[model samples]
Target: MEEKKVRIHLEKHYWPDEIRARRKRNLGRILALVGLVLTFVFGWVVGSTFATGEPVEETTDFAKLEAIYQIMSEDWYFGKDVLELQTKLIDDAINGMVDGGGDIHTSYLTSEEAKQFNDSLNMGFVGIGVQYYDSNGTYIIERVFRGSPAERAGVLPGDIIFKVNGAEVTGIGSDELAAKVKGENGSIVEIDFLREGVTVSKKITRAPINNTAYGEMIDAETALLEIYTFGDTTGNEVMDILDDFETKGAKRLILDLRDNGGGYLSTLETIGSFFVEKGGILIQQEFINGTTDTSKSSGFVTVDWEKIVILVNGNTASASEVLVAALDENLGEKVTVVGTLTYGKGTVQTQRPFSDQSILKYTIAQWLTPSGKKIDGIGITPDVVVELPAIMENGFEPLEEGETIAPDSVHVAIVSLQEALSFLGYDVDRQDGYYSPKSVEEFKKYQATYGTTVDGVLTQEWISRLHADVARVWHEE
Candidate 1:
């Protein structure tokens, strides 16, 4: 491995607020479902306030909280800045309120977090377009967006991001690594990575990356629409995609919502209006006060004709659920859901920014389908279930040196390993629940190519790599 020094060029001045705002307006600020978006019901309410009729009974004694704050501020073993302590206290308090309640969707966002959340809505960011995860000790590329600078630069899935700007980030936290990769548009960020034990470096120009929805005709009669996330412009984006689908003569559509975490409620409603009938109920929201509100479709039906199949996985949630439920309820036999069950987030969140710009995303109401089905903890079951095969994390046991499993071996783990290998494009002749000679040969070739021990045996590291490779290809394709 060669040591390389890479310097990132930074902009000298920040864009004016007006210019930034204009850029945001120009860019469709929304992800399909991963990025947070304002709720449709409360998005219009800014700086809302409530007048208390009476002092509510305190659930917990305030004196205990005060004592803790006093002890931390004054009597702690180490001295701390009052402002910093105050900020931490506020953050913890908010966390306790939401997180402690066991509602994963409700969250507190600090000023920085709030900024990032808002930035994601812009649908554009300056970075080498890749989403990664920190595995045991390596930073593995989970996804490389199509046409991204990273993709254009030959960044591939399952590649280990060993260094950013020549600095080793072996054990770096995800947030810190993200900050390192993101910069002003047009800036350069050098990335050094390990692709199958080979060190590769690329000088990537950070540019405005769009989180766009994808739609392409898979065949003359079938089209695939992959919704990345619902953002400000997603409704229009979807409409444009449908137009293209129509132009290409696609009659059957596959709506891929797998891994979509849910996005803007407004975007959901807008998109739902296209598939649902005019004046149809999109979702029913029940507030904490026992009052409920029913959101109806805008009565605008855009595309007409044929069958639709919605693909959902465990990560499909929130607004995505809304869209799925709406179309399922309204279209009935026209829509069929496939894949695993969804994330099952039935609650809607309202975001409010405080004076200090910190944001609080608290649950306001529970959303129900038009038929009055509540899908909170219990997710919407698919009509056609296609559960993904589980990837063995570093297989059951490493095949030690000098020990070769012949075709007679009937271990269940080997069967799983063979399946994974085949899924990742390896030519494993047949996955017949046995470790055949061809399987061993293919495994040895894979090991040799990736610099693994070429002993034609499995190890923990080898299995983990196999799992990652399969996942990468599964997701990317």
Candidate 2:
């Protein structure tokens, strides 16, 4: 029997320096070849759309583009598909133009990828509802949607997936894995995962996930409204939640926008109207030609809340930032922003689908708050900056197996570890500065999620990973 190679692929973030540098070199060559053409085309398109009333010169020479394509087709070291190569050339040119400007939010999506992106905002898909990312050498689960099959199957953040449907997937990319995991509604798929060094198998049935926006009363007068992303139906969902809050007599509201990467611009306006005054500017859009437009709120304040606190983090971006700023500026003292700095994103992108079904999401305008605050590279500083400081002994050795730090034998490090676990969504009740059986159980769960030895003993690697995951959660939040 022939042996198969087990290939380990790391994400770009974990790529070696040489590999990244080589990629940059290749990218530079492609950019250099197509830079002029892209610039000319972009300018011409913009002029045609807006009609600046001034004549623009045509300086781009198409000969260079033809020459590069010819060289790649004939003299390239490998066999090439001219059609695919042309598509790639056009896509790369647009991507380079957008990326070169340092606007990470603007992107170019292929036909299939664009459909997936649109599907995320349309409603939901038939899948296990776990978001995974490629890490060091495995596909690590990043998030499990609430009430999802993955969550029901006990999938947790940091759990490493080993196989799908009896096929080894260690060498597959995250996108391919996602496609494999998703199926027709009511279909079943098998998953093998490594948790706490134990191989666990699960059979999860695919179903529609529609909990994009949801809320619950945290207390008699406090409600926690979590908006995962602003989408087509987000306004209606939020309105329904507000009605529910009114019915529940919840006067205090906590808007949780943590980990929300934002969605539709029209949805922002619709949602903003609930709090902002009627016909007030929600966000100002400034174009490249010194022109500006404003998206105004409908001024239909529905639910009345005396106190409102918005919980945001680095992942709160774009439309999320717009909503936060609108509420804070319009409502004044009634609204307060809590958490770390937001994920500074101030540009509004316009997605234009081409004839081939591909989509080009290009930055068309820079957004500003109603109060004229620009939140681009510099994120919006929270009114209350909350952070968990990592307190660890410089030379303290990690607790090994069988080396217990029980109630009688106390260790201050235990409290810090407990706090970390609690922040990472582990069931570590409270940071009582004691290593109890509860702590041991949660510690084991963390170990399982990270595929570490389930000895209930914290290792140096575990501590390091805990710190890193904490940072990751905050940044991705």
User: Residue-wise lDDT of candidate 2 within 332-440, one digit each (tens)?
Assistant: 9999999888878787777655555655566677889998889887778899988734332221234543345544235766776787887777887657667778888
State the displacement of the C-alpha of residue 249, model 2, in Å, after optimal TM-score superposition.
1.5
Evaluated with TM-score, which candidate comes out highest? 1
lDDT of 1 by residue, 168-192 (tens): 9866676678889999988999999
Instruction: Please provide the root mean square deviation of candidate 1 (C-alpha atoms, Å).
Output: 13.3
My TM-score estimates for the predictions, one after another, are 0.73, 0.69
- How well does model 2 score by local distance difference test? 0.69
Q: Report the Cα lDDT for residue 186, model 1.
A: 88
Clashes of each: 12, 4
Error of 1 at 17 (Å): 26
